[model samples]
Target chain A: MNATPEQVVELLRQTNFSTLDWAIVVVYLCVSLVIGVWVKQYATDMAAYIGAGRSVGVWLGVATMTGTELGLVTVMYSAQIGFTGGFAAFHIAVIAGLVTFVVGATGFVVAPLRALGVLTIPEFYERRFDRKTRVVGGVLLSVAGVLNMGLFLKMGSIFIVGVTGLSPDSGALTVVMTVLLLLVLAYTVMGGMISVIITDYIQFVLLSFGLLLTVGVAIWRLGWENIFQVVAAEKGAAGFDPLQGEGEFGPEYVLWMLVVGLIGCAVWPTTVARALAMESTQAVRRQFMWSSISFTARFLIPNFFGICAFVFFSTHSTEMRELFLSPLPGGASSAFTPSLYAMPVFLGHLLPTGVLGIVAAAMIAAFMSTHDSYLLCWSSVITQDIIAPLAKSEMTDQRRIFITRLLIVAIGGFLLFWGLFYPLEGDTIWSYMAITGAVYFTGAIPVLVGGLYWKQASTAGAFSALLMGFTALVGLEPVRQTLAKTLAPVMGDSETIAAALSAERCGLAALLLTCVMFVAMSLLFPDTRPDARQRD
Target chain B: MSVWIMIWKVVFVIALSAFAVLAVGATIGGARDVVTLLNKLKQDRSNTKSDQ
Candidate 1:
């Protein structure tokens, strides 16, 4: 398994392409398209398109949540993380699930928010805080959503093309983006949550089938024990230890993720929309409770896939070093390359032709689900949060729908442009997602908690929290660069160390610190008073 | 993947993944059951109130 250049080349040669692989890819695509087309019957109006008419029961919500959460990049990164960092990377998935479970159990944040019957999280801010606070939250959520979506098309294209052994850099980002948008628009524009949930059920089944095939083939090639041994020998202690490594994230990373997972998970516009789509609080809570199981199961498989890739790559150190150490455009580090390449390499090496195609389709499904939700999420927030609040006219439902679809086109178009042209500099896709998330993750707690608890939390606190959280994220950029430089010698390679550091820490800190600041300021500035229009 | 273990793993994955599907199915089924039960309870309550 220690693949030198010669070994890699030989492996590539041994890997025969069959008709079965092509068949798998074709079949998967056709089925997903059919599902998209079929869901049209459910769409009665715009509300139905967005929230499935608040008709989503527990099962559909849970399934759709799983599908939305498990994106192509998630699988790719998990495999990549496993390939490089060993078992430690699995912690990310574990913590996310456990935290989500805790959130469900407590019924603390989202349960109450869902009970309020508001459309979006930012709308909650408008009701609870001031117009200015809502605007800030809305803008922040939209930007966060857009930036987080920056890599989807590129990453999806990479996975699809790579699995098919086609041109990896097809420069087809725009075409791919358009295809994804059209697919999402077709059903999403129709029945909204109904279409999303119904389609997601089928997609979830197919993806699970595909992942099982991939895992089976890999285990057949190298027994699980052998895989574990190879990885253990290669990575030593740091490989499996989630707490250690370059970031010095240690326990704090876990703690931060737990808090973010608990509070931030519910606050995101995309998820908030999903919660609102449910028929009732009981439905939302029950769906999540059941979802906790599915979430945990899916969580482990991807992490395991990652760990398997790590073990498989260990004996192939020469290739690993080459993949990691190679300079990316804009002086991007090798750390970014190998992990990114891990899933592709694993699929190319392991899967049987028929199963391979199925997996390819599953990857595409993941991409589409993520894209559709993101498009819907940001667009809704923008319309409801930013535009509608500011506009003097009471908007009609028809007008609202028109604006929503238009915003989708506008925002989706921007992402396509950014995805194609955005220089891959400064951060990994994971960090970018997290950093953008911190914009809300850090700011929301004060607003949400204050809205729920303290009547005295004035507009000043909300504004300060928003400003302070953004400042933390923006300020961390230079600090990150300096930290990378300072720790370069000890890290052996500075960029990976730097990339790892940000992914593990900064966002959570910024988010948590913002929460702390909001509470402190609210207590201190008690006399600032509330907006009368916001309350009864 | 061991033959036996692989079979079990496949089954487990399928079961876990089908949760969402089951949720939808159950909600419909559960609602019907609930409605029927509620109706029965209401009829008995009305009859008792009239007799009293």
Candidate 2:
């Protein structure tokens, strides 16, 4: 008889986590909170609060950038990719590294933006186009950014629950999510970017060493050669070749990854916020170039762990294989989904008590570093780009900071509610993130690149491009499913139609269409007057 | 093994090694940067007070 979902959960709960591990995690959390609160006095001005006084150096910039981007959510989703896609998933890491390196070497969008010395990306929109463009861009960016991170708290909580071997049905997930959010909000609202930068640096150090240690232990335990052998046996050429039509990813996915990679380093607001914080444009370039190593390793290391988890489960026992690989005992109605839990559960079993505690702390560090930066980034954008510009009276720096802190709390509340209620049923965490993120980046790529590079990028063109980004929302799983169901009678099969409207295809089409619209609109109805603030 | 698998193995090793080096370098260098940043903030605060 097939093992029930309850049995699987019971089996998963058997882990090496101990009281010693809990002490280590608690101590680390205390130190991070202390450091964050200690830095509150430094945030006496808007620049210090939001951009760390624009005093960041190259190595620090690289470290903070990695800390923010190599988030727990990134690890969970990348590992899930590896579990499902095998070696084919490594292509995404390679593309990410190369694209980041090129962006650094060329200083494409970052260099010019740094030279302008704007606090946010939408601030640049105002300088190049008009105040209206800035406000609209800010609104779009905040919406997409918040939606993109909607699953982060839940994903982090899932990691904590799995690694600690807590029973998922015992309300542990909700408790963990609430505690992590409260901790992050306490530090972030207190210290703003100053605390964020300091904490990110520390987290970067711990996460790097922790990752290497885990990978080393995994390789030693599983035997490197055996990993390849099993993957080759089970998945065939499709596992190794991303371009294989039967593989998890194909030509279109590879192309889409390239765009995603570019946007990740160059156009993403949180990453660009690092650039804005740097001491010089030269530092920004160097930071990205050096950060390419981290950008690649973040994905590559987690992916290897996922692959290891697959090997472990496959070789461990018959029941293990069935639990992870086979359809649910009762089919799609079953409550358990195994992919996201695989890596954490494997770690909980593999690592010893003390070492497991340290790694867990490091992962929590990753979680907090990402949350603080994101909360600060979005809240500041709303204050500086959206609200400040719209306010009739000139707002004081103190007023702006107060509003930002309040918004941070508001956004945190929304994340808690969304994480609890949102259905993560039909899509992978990574795909959900990409589709939501595309709602901003698809439009941003055109508006940012055009406004910076092309002389004729008008306010109207920018507006049209920014509005066109909403079309990428069709790639969301629920929306796509609804469209597919509604059209099934007329268009043959719902599943086939949904598959045809894949996230990559939709995102790429939206990107191309937005670019064309931007250019056409600019050429057709050029700005009547060249603004004095427009860059050459 | 197929060429694709071999390529990934090589790539993974290189990426991991490079990241290890970056981690060490960033740790030491980032410490000094943190000090420099704090000092700069202190100076900026003093300047603001004097202006007032």
| lDDT tens digits by residue: candidate 1, A98-122 | 6667767776677888888877887
Going through the candidates in order, what is chain B's TM-score? 0.64, 0.94
Model 2 chain A: which ten-residue window has the lowest total lDDT? A327-336
Q: In candidate 1, which residue ranges exceed 4 Å CA deviation?
A: A1-20, A170-178, A246-249, A316-336, A475-479, A482-503, A527-536, B1-52
Docking class of 2: high
lDDT of 2 by residue, A1-536 (tens): 57765787787788999999999999999999999999899999898999999999999999999999999999999999999889889999999999999999999999999989999999999988899999999999999999999999999998998899887767888899999999999999989999999999999999989999999999999998999998899888888899987889999999999999999999999999999999999999999999999999888988888888988888888877877777666652233568988899989989999999999999999999999999999999999999999999999989999999999999999899998888987798989999999999999999999998898888889999999999999899999999999999999999999999998999999999899889999998899888546445
Interface RMSD of 2: 1.0
In candidate 1, position A159 carries an lDDT of 63
**What does the lDDT read for residue A192 in candidate 2?**
96
TM-score of each: 0.81, 0.98
lDDT of 2: 0.92
**What residue runs in model 2 are displaced by over 4 Å at the alpha carbon?**
A331-335, A532-536
